[model samples]
Target: MDSMASAPGKAILFGEHAVVYDKPAIALAINKRATITIKESHKDYTSIKSDNIGLEAIISPETGLKLKKGEIGILNYILKALEFYHDSKPIKIKLEIEIPIGAGLGSSAAVTVATIAALDKYHKRKTTLPSIAKRAHKVELEVQGAASPLDTSISTHGGLIYLNEEKKIDQIKGDLKDSLVIGYTQSEDTAKMVKLVKERMERHPTIINHIMDAIAHTTKKAKKALETNDKECLGELMNINQGLLDAIGVNTRSLSDMIYTSREAGALGSKITGAGGGGSIIAYSPNRTRKIIETLKRKGYNAMKADPSKKGVIIEH
Candidate 1:
């Protein structure tokens, strides 16, 4: 028997770096997702394969996890997730990922969440959503060194998620109504960007602390806007959040151009969606979504529409 699961990726709307400091952040699960399929292995040791990263390897208690040269570390999320299950039976794991890697779209979280869900179902553990979320967060913390619960929580619960300073996860009552447009450049190192912000915060604690406070306030306002379906207010708040992200030195030339160009093309508000060194930017354009996408394409950007996903991790059998 094969147990398969899929989890949606996420886009941070109002907060990113500030959330690491226990500030509030808002995120929504996107349609893009990562799917994992698990089956009992005939071989003695467990094996993992992912065409997305073009790698395959064996994982076992005796040998431990090993990565070949030139392979990325995103697989660490999978390895860490496997550690929690404690299943003696070896399994063959396969990954099918739609979300772009290292683009700050919560790819790691999606993969981790899906992997855990699949394993739980395969082992007949029947883990609850909160339990799955907690385990996934642990995997992220182990792999990333520093990670907020926002991504893992959103990936586990789906819909619009509000993560508070207390690390509480809430599903906001509202919908994006297909107003979101994503423009992505090259992949960015989320950990590196996060460390950069940390360094800046250490050098100027007072100033950076104020900026975090402002981002938290903006995230709160954006939450209300989402509940009330106030697209205009949400857009404005997003712009404010973008400026704060820039102040933290996460902005890049290409990301800035994409944002400004989207705004000029009639985006109500446009800003970086994640750690923001070279990942992706989101534009809230509502009826003008197509126009913004076309305009962004003309400027040599990869742009697309991503609707908010209401479903989280699920067993597919």
Candidate 2:
């Protein structure tokens, strides 16, 4: 018998860095997802392979080589747990992440969650969203030294979420009035951007504080707009966040131009999604989403319009 689990990738719609400092953040699980599969076998050792990212590994219970690594290091936490179960029965596992990597989307976290969940089911383990969150939060540290809980939380929970400073997750159910156009800038370097931000934080403490303060204020309005179903206010808040990112020196010329172009084409508002410095931009405007995509396409930018994902982790045999 084989067990499988899948999870949707995510993006920080708002409040990326502030969440780390105890501020509210919002995230959504997009349509793209990854899957993890496990099968029971009689081999002397269990093997893990991921054809997507060139990862492969083997684990043996007899030799005490149980640490999860190589092709699927995201399952390290699950492997540690497996040591306690002592399955003894050798197994084979295969992991695959179909989500576009380094798109400022939470591809890695989604795959990590899927892997843990798959293993949990294979062991008949009870895996709650909170448990999955805790596990994936730690796994994210391996991929991104320090990632806000927003990604894992949303990916695991499978909905639009409001994460408060208290680590309390509140799922906000509302008609996301506008669609978003995702413009792929094709440049991704989270590590470099993190280092840049840290250096800036250490050198310009005051600037960082001011930006975070503005972000907090804008985020409040953004959430309020959502609660009130006010699209205009939400768009304005997105614009505010973009400006704040500019102040932090993470926004690139290409991203800014795309945002400007999208805005000009018809987007109500736009901003760089993740760590900035070249990733993807989200522009909210249901009416103009198509126009924005067409405009960007004509300009040679690979932009596509997408909506929040309705489901997470669809498994196929």
Candidate 3:
């Protein structure tokens, strides 16, 4: 039997670095997804392959081998999923991901969750969303040394999610699709970026604390904007949130370029989407997505018109 599963990528609409400080953060699942296929194999060892990351390796389920160096090191998360479920049967696994790696697009979370979902189904173990998310969070923690449940939760449940300091998660109801444009600055050092923010906080705790409180406040208003379907208000909050992120020193030159360029091109609001020293930026362009995409691309930046994903993980035989 073959088992296939897929999970969507995610973006932080409001609150990035502040979320680490236990501040409220809002995230949306994007249309892009990472998919995995698992099939029992007759061979003695299991093998995994992915052209997207140019990884091909065969390892004994009993004793895994060392993986190649670099960001593809994230495959450790997938391997951890297999071990978690104790499915030792030799199998062939294939992964295909639409999310960009290290761009703060939840590529790691998507792939890890999809891997666990596929393995669980392959072994005839019907797992719950909370269970899958918990296991995926472990994988991230082991790999990143730190992780927020927001990415794993959003990848597992999809749609719009609001997460607060107490770890309460709510699925906000609204149709936010087609109202945002996402731009990538080709950042490959999320760990380094996160470290920069931590250093700033170490140097100025009081200032960082105030910024975190402001971001939390903006997140509450963001929830109101979503419930009331107020795109303009949401845009304004994104602008405010971005300013706070800039004050905390997470904004990079490339990120600022994308944010300002999109705003100048008629985006209602724009800001860095994730661990912002360098990564991706999001712009609220309800009516001018095409114009925003064209402008960003013409300026030689990687850009795409993005919409929110309604479903989390989908399974197929």
| Reference-based lDDT, each prediction | 0.88, 0.76, 0.86
List pairs with backbone clashes in candidate 2: 6-313, 55-71
Per-residue CA lDDT of candidate 1, range 216-306, in tens?
9999999999899998898899999999998999999999999999999998899999888898999998888899889999999999898
lDDT at 84, model 2: 39
Winning candidate number (lDDT): 1
Clashing residue pairs for model 3: none
TM-score against native, each model: 0.95, 0.85, 0.94
Model 1 alpha-carbon drift over 4 Å, by segment: 60-70
Q: Write the per-residue lDDT of candidate 3 for residues 1-317, one digit (tens) a residue.
A: 89999999999998787777788899999999999999888998887888887777777746766444234455777778877775577898998988888788898899999999998898888799998888998888777776778899999999999998987889998667777899997674556666777887899988888888999999999999989989889889989999998898777888999999999999989998988767799999887899999999998889987789989988786
- Which segments of model 2 are wrong by more than 4 Å? 41-46, 50-90, 312-317
Backbone collision count in every prediction? 0, 2, 0
Which parts of model 3 are misplaced by more than 4 Å? Answer: 61-63, 66-71
